[model samples]
Target: MDSDDLGLFGPGSVTWKVHEEPILIVAGLRSLYLQSLHPRAMAGVAQNSNYRSDAWGRLVRTATYVGTTIYGTTAEAEAAGLRVRRRHARLRATDLFTGEEFRVDDPELLRWVHVTEVESFLDTARRAGLPLTADEIDGYYTEQRRSAALVGLDPATVPGTAAEVADYYRRIRPELRMTREAAETALFLTAPPIPWKLSLPARIGLNLGPPRWAYFGIAGTALALLPAWARRMYGGLGLPTTALSADLSVRALRLTLATLPRRWREGPLQQAAKERAARLAGTPA
Candidate 1:
């Protein structure tokens, strides 16, 4: 089904159309954040072999991650019209094993979302003062154009205009909340491995990074409660930078808890996680 069919663009209601909601902004942020944590999610685009280096790879990686996580399958991601190609550079289409011609860049809703997500990622990274070069930024946009064309956009209607992009977001940002199941699944999926007990293979994976719980709350209530303090702790403790699952998990738990209004710490997600932890530890939650 088309994004329009899903009430993404907000059917004919001015209030829905005119307002730019936090859900959409958060959607963009969440897509980028998840991609940063799961760079391998972009396996299709990054490993395309056809388009090698430049911003295209980064954008593709970001888009691929968003597609896999949000849609739950690679084939579905492809069917949703997610792919990348170059504009004014070179052709980079690949042939599937079934001998079908595949173009990664099209102007479909998926590509638009991908581009927006990638742009948001770059913007956030830039804000964080990461060590990316200008060449990288140019490469990202080049890839962006390729990705846009993969879906069906005629290059002309690529929403190159800022107002146009903003207008589009104004229409599509409200219906993006996480379902309870989705929230829980995402919470777990994004978490780092718990070392409660594991086999050699599992331990090997755990050794690759710190446990997820260590980083989960850095940006949520913990951040809000003690902004500078949290930053200092992350800096001084030298916590694992790759443990985003934990950081996001903590944020999700805190936000979920905060939704209770009266008793902040004893919310649904908090209770659930605590209960799970207790069961695992053989103690009361």
Candidate 2:
């Protein structure tokens, strides 16, 4: 049965190579930072997401969905996508800026989320010193259309190349803003409370140690890597070398993480997928 399922992205795909990096968490955070800049997008997340009240649970669920889509069997990936589509179809939010109602699953909004997400991942991977050429980077964007489709977007309408993505962002930039909701989201991300799901002792530990440092480091890196225009919206006309410093910091972070034991860093979904792939190849994982 394992042999029959390689998930949405097999081990050979650039998506797998990129998403498996321990540093993708920074990329994920960066996506949140970027996506929140869109007023309607921020409104949808603010209205429906439980990150404020159940931050840990929300994190786990989002991770599960992403892992399942990338590493679970093909059926698992499709099932996860179906669950997302159904959930989205039932949710609506008021656009505070426009005083209008908008569906969470609106293709335009979905497109915004998809682009920010894939772009952040690519950007973070590159900055973290991943050895990717321009062609491979573009290929990564093309490969992400499968992910965009999972959330009810038409793959044909989604940007499939790096140039297309940049052009899309250019066309959409005028609509982006730092709404109150966006600013609040950024503040919460910078210093999120310890996940309530942890034991009291665990929460206390998280508040004081490397766990805390890691989270802040990632948050800071995300903020540092924001485009200059984004920084201006957030009230900083950043220094000329902001981009260069962000790149250096990411490279340092990646090197630090590479020293950790693989078993301690790899998530179960990723490990399991690798095991399945090995089994299919008659080799050990």
- What 10-residue stretch in candidate 1 is worst by lDDT? 14-23
Candidate 2's TM-score: 0.94
Q: Residue by residue across 18-52, what tens digits does model 2's lDDT show?
A: 98788888888888888999999899988998889
Candidate lDDT scores, in order, read: 0.37, 0.87
Once model 1 is optimally superposed onto the true structure by TM-score, how far is the C-alpha of residue 172 displaced, in angstroms? 0.8
Model 2: residues >4 Å from true position, as ranges?
Answer: 196-214
Candidate 2, RMSD to the unseen true structure: 2.1
